[model samples]
Target: MKLIHAELIKLASLLSAWIAAGLATILPAAVAVLNSRSQVSRGIDAGFQDLAPGVIGAIVIGVVAVSSEYLVEGAESGGGRQITTSLTAVASRSRFLLAKAAAVAVTVALLALLSSAITLTTTSLTDETVSVGTADLPRVAGVTAYWILTALLASGITLVTRSGIVPLTFCIVNMSVVSVSFLLTKLTSWANYLPDLAGMHLFLRDVHGSVDIAPLTGGLVMGLWVVVVAGIGFIVFRRRDA
Candidate 1:
């Protein structure tokens, strides 16, 4: 419990978390407002679809949690890394990782919830034709779950790499520039089961792909990926020297 609290405090202190919060809230809300006010007619699902871009924020949350620990201090600070101190204090790698992961998950879930509320409300006010009601609660919950899973995926990758560069770039690019997995869907229907693609079904009514994934099935598939990545990261984190 102490470890979890400490980890949460560490996350709260990070500027990256604040930047991530901005991405999660601002991007979606801005998109919703634009969709609402624009002359171009969009489906009533515009608000929900806007949530897609916010995954970048979730990815950032995961990467920075691990990456921040690995950052080496300058020579003036004895050129040491925080991970060494963290491990020295905790003594148990599993406990430390678990606590850190929990912290990241909690931070991301809250961000997701906030983003959903702001974005949905923006849409509802901007376009009276779009209504958000109790029925959308489940989808909102799904969005939070999706963000948690996405954050975990980023955390797992960062743990193994011990650096944020690769994981952060890949995840941000995948969500922003172009989806490598989404492109693969053209060649194989099974690509529809990829984490991001499947996860989108949780809140999105219209996914531009050939395969049709039920929300529950998509969540299951994404969850499976999270388990696999987390397991691999745990093994690597345990065996590798800090």
Candidate 2:
């Protein structure tokens, strides 16, 4: 509990966290409003489509949370990294990692819920044609879960690299408007199995072509990927010097 509390406090102190949280809350609404006004018609899955870019905020949150620990304060002075202090205080790498992950999970989950709600509400208000039925509840929940998993995926990747730039660049680029995965899907059906592509199946009801999998199965596949990468990160973090 103490470790988790400390981790939360540490996250709260970062400017990046505040920016990420704000983006997570605002981007969805902005996208929804744009979509509502656009003359081009979006199909039934418009809601999810508008909300998708908001996940970038969750990704940033995850990467920043872990990478901040490795930052050097003053190269000339040789001030130690924050990870050194964190490990010294906790005295257990595994415990500290767990606390960090827990803090990230909780924060991203709340952000996801807030973003989803705001997006859904904004979509309904701006576009009366868009439905907000109870039937869509599962899709909303799936989006929340997707954000949490994506955040964890970023966290795990950051742990392995010990730097935010690599994971953040790759994730944000791959998830952008001209997504690498989307382009790859045009070439090979197997691209559907990519982590982001597969996970999006959970909430995306109208994925036009490539490959189709059950929502639960897609979640499981993405979760497995996160577990494998996170496991490798854990091993490296345990054996490596802090």
Q: Candidate 1 on 1-242: residue-level lDDT in tens? A: 89999999998899988899899989999988877878876674678888878989999989999999989999999999999999999999999999999999998999999999999998889988888899899999989999999999999999889999999999999999989999998899899998999998898878888988899999999999999999999999999899
Candidate 2's C-alpha runs over 4 A off are 74-78
Clashing pairs in 1: none
Best by TM-score: 1
Q: Rate the local accuracy (lDDT) of all candidates.
A: 0.91, 0.89
The true-structure Cα RMSD of candidate 1 reads 1.1
Q: How close to the true structure is residue 197 of candidate 2, measured as C-alpha lDDT?
A: 85
Lowest summed lDDT across 10 adjacent residues in model 1 is found at 37-46
CA error at residue 194 for candidate 1, angstroms: 0.7
Per-residue lDDT value at 139 in model 1: 93
* Backbone atom clashes (below 3 Å) for every candidate: 0, 0
